[model samples]
Target: MDLSIRVIRSDEWEKARELRLAALRDPVAHLAFLDTYEAAVVRPDSFWQERTEGGSEDGPGTVRQFVAEAPDGRWLGTASVLVERAGAESFFADVPEGEQTHVVGVFVREEARGSGAIDALFEAAVEWSWSLAEPRVERVRLFVHAENARAQAVYRRLGFAPTGVRVALHGSEDAHEVEYEVLRPAA
Candidate 1:
């Protein structure tokens, strides 16, 4: 498909913002993401600039965003990883047994689905997490809404298994997000 997967650069904030907005407008966005298009679109440019800068390749090691870009320079998909250390406060789920990376903001354009763009994006994200030095990450994890079967299947295909740990979804008292993990391979 002539696509390349790479970490985002701080200078590409505008492109990142555009792709994110497009992701938020997808039909399954409500099920796939925590933020709404209305809220995201209303955010000032500076917010996107800061967000991109923080998650860029040269930014802090705590988080990283990967994107699949076509030869034409359009982003086909994206995935982000958040580093979590045991005993530290986590913004998503509880701290894990050891240092880990939390995968989030997973999205692929409808036309790009089944084209392997999502897979490539995830591979880059996971590889980057495992490459961290000193206090290396022990695993990578993500939470999917219980009803999102499509996403669950894809994550399973990528080797993530349910950890049997469920947490209530934000803003919803009755629904839950199921945790999944891919343990680091033995050397």
Candidate 2:
């Protein structure tokens, strides 16, 4: 199906909420995302409303969410990027040495897998990161579950290389999240 990839608008919070809930229920959600469906489903509308608005185009501007939308207005998948600067206090892992963008909340509907939606979303995300003027992004990075080989393969194909850093998966003792990065192109 034909789709358009673009940053989500602040007023489209409902669509963002629905898409996020659907993503949390995917079969690979256990390995692909940090939040569980049960935890997310219980969140109040206000929470979703704020979360959606924060990632929208009109939000604080350090974060952005990109979605793949079908011509019929259905959202197929989504990805979000969080810009982290050195010495900043991050909600997850420690901020790396440079100003970089962390790719997160990535999800592509099963039906849309391998349809190029993922690539399009990431392209929009990385392009947007590179276009930032305040702190030039030095790299783009993302974490993948140790067992998520499918995602690792996709990241490799997209030119991201493992940075030899492994973070313990939240709430999991035996699992790890591998870090991968793509540096800014030489000018």
Candidate 3:
């Protein structure tokens, strides 16, 4: 089935929220997301409001979210990119003038995984990142659980290469996360 990829609007926050909750319920959610379903469920409307605004077309440059929607308007999957700057405190590291987009929260419904939903969502994100004019995004990156071979394979197929950086998992003494990067397409 064909799916369209686009940026979500503020008024459609509920759909975004619902898809997020569904993603949290996936079997590998523990490996894919940093937050738990219980934590998300209790977050107030204001939290959702801020999240929606931050990722919409008119929000700040720090973050953006892309979704794959079916013809009937149901969401198939989603992905978000966060712009990280040098010398700025990052969610996982401190960086020094170049801008990079960090891809996160990638998910496609089980039935939609092999179709084109994931690719479409990623293309949208990459397009948006490259479209930035000023602090031209230099690259797109994502971190994957070291144990998530499936995700790693998919990312590799999409042209991301391991950056050889490893971050220790916050609470898991034996686990680590690996970084992957894809250079920005030439103009």
Write model 1 residue lDDT over 96-182, tens digit each, in one string.
568988999999988899999988988998898899995599999999988889999999999999999888877789878889999
Tens digit of lDDT per residue, candidate 3, span 10-110? Answer: 77788888989999999998888888999998888888888988998777867888989888998999999988876788766655357888899899988
Predict model 1's lDDT versus the native: 0.90
For model 3, the stretches where C-alpha displacement exceeds 4 angstroms are none
| Off by more than 4 A, model 1 | none
Task: Score residue 103 of candidate 2 by CA lDDT.
Answer: 96
What TM-score does model 2 achieve against the real structure?
0.96
Worst 10 residues of 1 by lDDT: 88-97
The candidate 3 region of ten consecutive residues with least summed lDDT is: 89-98
Best by TM-score: 1
How well is each residue in 1-187 modelled by candidate 2, as lDDT tens digits?
A: 6999988998888888899889999988999988899998888888988888888989999999999999999999999999999888765578867899999999999999989999999899999999999788999999999999999999999889999888886567999998999999999
Candidate 2 or 3, higher TM-score?
Answer: 2
- Candidate 1 clashes between residue pairs 3 or more apart in a chain or in different chains: none
